[model samples]
Target: MDYRNESSDTLRNKCAACYRQFNKKEHLVEHMRTSYHSVHEPMCGVCKKHCRSFESLREHLIGPLPKAECERIFKERGCDICLSILGNRTSLRAHRESCLSRPNNNGLLYRMANLGIQDELRIDNSRGRVVALACKMVGGGSDGSLDLCARVCLIDEHERILFHSYIKPNIPVTNYRYEMTGIRPEYLRDAMPLKNVSRKIQEFLCNGEPIWQIRSKGGRSRILVGHGLDHDLKCLEMDYPAIKMRDTAKYPPLMKTSKLSNSLKYLTRAYLGYDIQSGVQDPYEDCVATMKLYMRMKLSQFHKKENYPLATDPQNKNNFASWRQNELERMTPDQLLDISRSDYYCWCLDSQDY
Candidate 1:
């Protein structure tokens, strides 16, 4: 125990492939047995820590127990969500300027109302109805309390702007989060109150139908689409039926290989070949991105119709999990391919007729 002559490599059993040091040889052997570690594993941008996966990288950067020094610097120069370090105060300032201010016509509500359209959203009856929702948050307190919704936008499947408004929060705004939200005190001074915005959004989403009616009687309710929708909806003080939600953040196929959800910006770039949320966040752009992502998943041919509710039904868990070794071996390649293997219920299951 007193010996200081051991080589560093021997003291820390480092895996050859991943270069991760384990305290014991047995742990390194166990890691290798899974065949999970590789050189391709994501590395932290700042610390250069080789993570086992993107999820590990995310936890390293932003999770509860992040590296203290990295977290401190990250708070000053890094994007909390994307984990991108902006490098120096000047660069971060420039990034903030572009990030918060999207190029669009000013006076969102006035422009939408004066277009000679009805107050209610005009849903296209022919195509499957989908509506995208986005919300901007204003800071609550210095203690990182819940942010209030300061703005909201809703768009249709046809990319039509249905509703947009600056919402006055119920509580006083402690942090405008101007760099990300692009909201100023003057903007909210004359903005519509939270109650009015909530009422309008409810009317738009429900399409003049009661919530109960939509659930029980198969009434028409526009499919709600967005990224991190639950958070947005919570901030907006709004609710929608769970089954009708098509969230880019929760969709299984769009998730990371580790089964962790990818950021909306990342997903947009990967799937749609475009960048978004690069600077001041625009709700309209967010709506469009979510809508596009939702449509892409809904129209995917990867999901076979025959799989149906079986992928989600808890009752079938035993049947699927307890497949005999002999039974699996006996299956033809085509038969094995036919086996349902989705991580989540397909959104298309509700959107289209099988």
Candidate 2:
């Protein structure tokens, strides 16, 4: 009788997020309510098992006592960086090659192209310009605790510099942090004024469309890619529509195992397999690193539609409604996961055509 009861318990429904088994489907739903499971949580591509951290996911894949079948499949198709399971070995090879390439700045350097009419830009084939931005800050205020933007750089998808300039700070700079920034007082002496630089970047990002229209998809406004864009834009005294921004630091897949923002330097080395910001940080180098990361994510070919939550769709309600409790309890574990909705938007969605 005890053996029979144990076997019945093995058949219980499990919450994918917390991996808690329940006797009933409704009980599993209740567990999810407080589990706070989200798309940001690291998930196994094979079994769709969600883990609390990338470390847990890594263990589930290759650590001791891994799931037998999942470990078998992941060994064949998993990506070490993004942890995505590709369709085949060929796809995995191609994906890994792109995912772990060293950063390169082969794009055209700063120059006045076509007598400066080209605006120092190399445009990609995208509907609007997709640019990566980076900024270097010198400290200001008492005890050198404040950030004052001293240098800014923008690069296109091809890693070509669109704009690079030192800014004359509105306030006095107390610490240049020369070892890291390589910025000296002389660099800002004849630099462009903050207002002019801000206006130029604002106009360039909007691309002649009204600022209000930037929120709309596929509009003329440029897509801004960078790490920590909130702070960068804040320092620049500029505003951009949130939807148009692709911030690496905030993107879920690139986050640390603990769900915190990863440093750009660490992300570059881990994903791109190269060091950056090791010496005096160059804004151009930072821009290139971010652009590579953005392109890698933007071009991801992972299957996402089934797990994506179209929250606006009235028909896409949660699967655990009371009326369907019996039906859900009878479904397999994989089916339960199929009906589960991701709590955050996946970046791979950006590759989809509207």
Computed on alpha carbons, the lDDT of every model, listed in order, comes to: 0.64, 0.74
| TM-score to true structure, per model | 0.61, 0.80
Candidate 1, pairs of clashing residues:
99-279, 99-280, 100-280
The C-alpha stretches of model 2 lying farther than 4 A from their native spots are 1-3, 16-20, 31-48, 51-56, 62-79, 82-99, 105-128, 257-259, 306-308, 312-332
Across 1-354, the per-residue lDDT of candidate 1 in tens digits comes to 634634553445565443566655555554443433322234566765546444566667777898887777777887543345777878877755543323234324433442222244543344346788888788887653678998887877776777877888988888888888777887888788888887777766777677766761256776789989889988878787777788888775466754578888887775565677876777777888788777755653233345334434565343334344345434432333234234345566665453
| lDDT of model 1, residue 4 | 60
Instruction: Indicate the TM-score of model 1.
Output: 0.61
How well is each residue in 141-162 modelled by candidate 2, as lDDT tens digits? 9888799998888878877667
